[model samples]
Target: MTQTVTTSAVRARASSPALSGPGLFTVLLAAALPLVDFFIVNVALPTIGADLAAGEAVLELVVAAYGVAYAVLLVLGGRLGDLFGRRRLFLAGMAAFGLTSLACGLAPGAWWLVGARAAQGASAAAMLPQVLATIQAATSGGRRARAMSLYGATAGLSMVAGQILGGVLVAADLAGSGWRAIFLVNVPVVLLGLVLAVRYVPETRSPRPEPVDGPGTVLLAVSLLTLLAPLTEGRAAGWPLWTWLSLAAFPLAAAAFYAVERRADRQGRTPLVPPSLFALASLRRGLMLILPFSVGFSGFMFVIALALQRGAGLGPVPAGLALAPMAVAFLFVSLSGPRLIARYGTRVLTAGAVVQGAGVLLIVLAAWRDWPHLGFGSLLPGVTVAGAGQALQLPNLMRIVMSEVPPARAGVGSGVMVTTQQSALALGVATLGTLFLALVPHHGMRDALVVTLLVQLAGVVLTGLLSLRLPRTVG
Candidate 1:
């Protein structure tokens, strides 16, 4: 009877109260961890390769494994949160994340670390969507908007900070851990997050949660793997025959996944990805902007890290510190984002793109002229301006995404949005990073870096044009 009563009470806790300040902080912290890990390894990769005796192909696997796993499992993780309870899932995922981080840090070999990183990503898939879903369900009106804005700020900041922090950690070599310090650092933070979550986070779930869509799940996984797997690994693997075969299968798999989900929606079943969800113009258009935005952001981070260290002959610390101006600029502009949105609305995005383009051009000029001499001083102006422009775009863009998503389907909405963002980040690394590396062998690093930045500038232009279609006023 006591056990039965406890079960009932657990279920009774589903209707969460408004998210408190501490609760919001807790979720936002959790949110930053995954994204931080995504880019953290950039500065640490060289040390990791040398220490583990791993080659380029295996090193690429270490990054791609995490990204693909994170992207593939995200929606399912969100759905599970809805059915079981979000707070419950958050705790479980956080625990798993801490354990996997420890595993990555302690691994005896490169393959072991790669496996652990994949697990780390899978755990992130379970944890991250809950951050947005919790905000969507537990807050509303202006509070909802504010919470979303904060989440976005945290996300954009984390991506930049990750590499910075990784450089610090790797250089510090605390207790002689070297590159292992990056993964080990997550363990302590995760433990703190777990404790705070239990105390401050509230239980929430769909009032009418649906069962998992198994077929849709499988097809979605296949679709992402078919495209991302080959691309991320192809260049490293020397474009193997299997990579070509996988790339060829991507379209067919995507088509089948869409048809399956559309059919499920038509049948009145809750598909993993509801086609009806895209009917929300805000979500749809916001996602369209996110794809290019994330692609450039991630690609630039990866390529710049490589170019600075390998081409400019900088160490990890110097390479990461060169972007300090960008991080500082991003923070300042991001804080003012809500005010700007209220005043100028979507025009801010266009203005941001233009400013960001100018920043990119400045960086190209710096790279072309400075070449091996390019250091923090030479790169400062361009990176600072670019960061500010990105600040205007990323956080506000995120607010526009969930602006119109209904509260009940918040889990699914957050899942879909994040999946798109994560997949794009992976592709950015795959495509832009590929382009830069491919150019380096024939063109040398300076020309390759300049060309890559030029390509990214083109993407910034595309993002600005897409922003024009965004609703003038996001709710």
Candidate 2:
């Protein structure tokens, strides 16, 4: 009789109505923090390099260190959340992130700052997977859609806002710390998130607990670190032999990781990432699309930020403000995303890709026409249109990816998706941004920017092609 009562109560909690108002707001806020940190540091890089007298390679590591650590540990973090409790991990991660952000703000040396940044990324990995997991476990149907949409919008907006906020803080030089202010600003925001989260966020985890695949976790981390670390830091560090070796080993490591996970799963063990998760066609294809989409997006932002500041002679503020049109356009179009997805389904994503491609083309043309005179006004239309296109796609893509993720596997699913995205983003900045910079010395900045935009256009086309494989409508 006691066992029956306990089982019924568990089901009741799982089937309860979705969070609303403050509860929903808290989740979305938590979701936005990692993305905000990702782009925020870009505009501050030059200032940091200047103030710290850091070399370009070390500076690139500062960014890459955070991203690589986050991407590598994400799956394990998710598994840990499932084994423990998402709320427990979320609170702990958020607290660590705040403290690390403080460390970043107060670092006296370049290496110390880099280490802190890595720690910050690890904390983000711990915190981020829970946002989506909690939403999945706690919400369903229309409520879930709304929560996911808000999460997507916050992500997109935060990416833009990070850069903008970084500029403002760097320029303001709060407490006369210059670029350090960008990180320092997070201290108060994080404290607030911690306070609200404790009050409003409910605890959640997999109802049927599963054992962590220890070996799978280790292998997965090795695979990601081997792949992402080199790709991100390689070009900046002049592509050492170890970088080439690491890249070469990626396929082997990935295949081995897969083999091990598949073996574990077949044995009725819970691999850190279950193969069953990919059985959902929408989730699989949606993740495929996310990779290229995120890669291009990050590449564009990183390359453009550098071009604007170093090439076009803009300050941090102006460079950051240049992305404002994209943010505005994204916000406006994203509000109508769900309705559009309901009507047109995956076709909307295709349309967004085409529109984004056009925007990139326009950017290429603007670069061609404006040459040395490229300015915020000149770049506005292209970026605005591109932002509109992205707004249409990103939210819908997110909805599709999470559509079929069983509540029980939500943590792992979110972890897998986010890891793919964050890894691709880091690589994009590393590869595309590297290509642009490499070309800048030989061909002028104008030509370099145009070429990079064209390459990104190809990525957008790939996204369009992949969209056809996505389910017509999300569950």
Candidate 3:
């Protein structure tokens, strides 16, 4: 009787609508939106500031607001999908994202843009988790692996392509839209995503859905705000007393959040972020690796945008074009990732780190040798090599992270993984960017860039060390 019931349950799950190519494409497109938006503004910030007469601090808020909102609300978004339906939340989030992007594009002042960006971030938090959750719930075996690889490729490419696209759009200045084009472009894409999502995507949810965890949710928000707010805005805001107070409160809030989660787990209730999930080696180690990698990745993107435009005297288009080599190289290597992972296991990630580190060294040497002459041609070799290295690691790391998570916990697991990555990206911008900016005045652009690259090299080495601990074989 027990065997019969178990088999029936398996059959029922297998019978649910599986994700097709079009469906996967749609969701991957959705996944690209938030990440692209995050980096797209890097090259556009100067234009935005000039056009709006915004100060340095307000411009920083424009970026920090979106990141903080996205990071803090990600877990809640995931849980909501598990409770209601992934497809439904995805559609609603997509629509809201479109509307918010319009608001951003139409903003009259700096504070207005900041508010719109915050709403856009919330919409992204709601939309992005469902992509991973849907993929987890609907596919299995090699098919799932392939979809995941594609998703990773899209993610890596989006970060680079975003800056490139932003430059192109800003240069085009469609109907005199200027810097606003970047935000406005999302409206049409979101509209298409909604249409396809309705036609192609399938709805899925946890069989035993749990209600929202109020205390865990509140504490998590507080914890993230306390940590990220001070770090991102402190330098721009002159390290005010409130920033210090917020930084001091971070540890306590984080600890309290953990305690509440632990208590909820013991009492047999769902928490916003379950502490027990970290017990899985794949998840814990994968996140550790992701943190350093994402930090270096985003920090480099931010720094390079600033350096190319301000230090090298390049226009927005030229500044964005400098990264083309990296984007192209990343796409090529990422496509070959699954086959390479099959043959070499997790060692591939270690190899990627080594290659990326070598590329970073090359970039540092080039910066030192050719400061004023730095351009697309000078950056070609280093960026190309680094992109190839990143391609090898990111998708494989994503696969390893989710390999052991059961389908029932898909939403939560995906939430946690994305939250970690998003938070690290923000941290990267805060710490490395702050360091670079501070050094530029005293040490000059060339020396400041060299020092930053060396620091990033250290992070790459740490990522390589962490990769060694991952499981030898992946599912």
Candidate 4:
């Protein structure tokens, strides 16, 4: 069955270019929006809270609501694209995302903003998987590798750039909207993306269409909500009894989701996530490694932003500017990732992890030495080094994970990979950020941040170890 699917997908790819050069750019432009939105709002949260009269706990909810919903429904969104068409879903999602961004910008209350954010996340889930799927279905060989690399670069850069752009927008407070400008900014971008998508983005879908796995879909959603909801929201909500109970149920729900998916696959039905996809060792292990890398990366970003602004008394623009060195280093190094991956194979990832770990250690040491006087200059060495290290790891990991995924299962493959990444990112913030906050009340903020950076350093080491299990080289 897997061979047949691969053969069919290869044949489809042989027929035509799914997108021209200009069209590919349009797809990538659309792809960057969700990732940008994810990180952009982090810097704006405090401003949003002050303006909306929201407390810290509610502010956490505002972020988690989008992430959790986005993670939970991703597989379903991917499957829908497979069932219908990639271009169609892409356009629909883009339109909805634009409307939701508008809703978020105009929201008068915290709860209303939170709801709009969730809607935006859902639309993002619908939109993003198609980017990977279309690339997969449309291209192969060097074309495919180049496209994936561009996607990886876009994904990594958007994360860092989002915060920087958000700070500028909020600080500028265009038309007195203040924090709302972070979201409202998406409206114009989305509109431009819509225009380009309609003109250039080509429609693609699985050549061998399979029925949607209704039971698998429901089980997966339940499993994700069960796992992610409590973890993300629990820390902010004071870790009530229900949160603990929810955490306990996660493993069981996950087991059930797998069981249902496996049964569907054996019965020759299209499972929400095909069991066969896991047979690709590169894809499987690359995904496993993505968990720790994504989690630690996100945790570090969230905590460091808070530490710079709240702990060190930097304003939003300065806080955002402080990360500019990291972003610049990330982009510069990331462009060379494909060449490095070709030469050094997965060793590049290991090298990146080692560098990143060292960078984290540097940050800890800097915090210890500088204490209350920490500034961007003091933080520069560690952030630049760490950004270079991350630039090496993230894009390479993305290429490795998707390397063996046949075009026919592109939607499922991309969905599974992204869901793991998104979930881990949320978990990192919940666990590490929570630990920092918990320790801050007891220890000084400087000490707490140092300890948290050390914890992230450990995660980087684990990722380095996991990279050893990957294939020697990526496609």
Candidate 1 TM-score, true structure as reference: 0.97
- Runs off by more than 4 Å, candidate 2: 1-11, 14-17
Candidate 1 per-residue lDDT, tens place, 350-407, comes to 9999999999999999999988899899999999999999999999888998998887
* Native-referenced Cα lDDT, model 3: 0.94
Q: Model 3 off-target regions past 4 Å?
A: 1-15
- Give the per-residue lDDT of model 4 (tens digit) for 1-475: 9999999898756644467788799889878898888888888999999899998878988888889888987887788887798889999999999999999999999999999999999999999899888888888888888788888888888888988898888899899999998888889999998999888888888877767888888888888888888878887888999888988988998999899888888988778898888999988999888999998988988988899889898888888888898899999999998888778888999999999888888889999999777778998999899999999999888888899898778888889988998889888988898899989989989999999998899899999999987768776
RMSD in Å for all candidates: 3.6, 1.7, 1.7, 3.3
What is the C-alpha lDDT profile of model 3 across 423-466, one tens digit per residue? 99999999999999999999999899999989999999999999
User: Of models 3 and 4, which has the larger lDDT?
Assistant: 3
Q: List model 2 lDDT by residue over 164-219, tens digit each.
A: 88888888887788888888888888899989888888888887768788888888
In angstroms, the error of model 1 at 412 is 0.5
Worst 10 residues of 2 by lDDT: 13-22
* Cα-lDDT of candidate 2: 0.88
lDDT (Cα atoms) of all candidates against the true structure: 0.93, 0.88, 0.94, 0.87
Better of 2 and 3 by TM-score: 3
Q: What local lDDT does model 2 show for residue 82? A: 81
Candidate 3, position 97, lDDT = 98
Flag clash pairs in model 2.
Answer: none
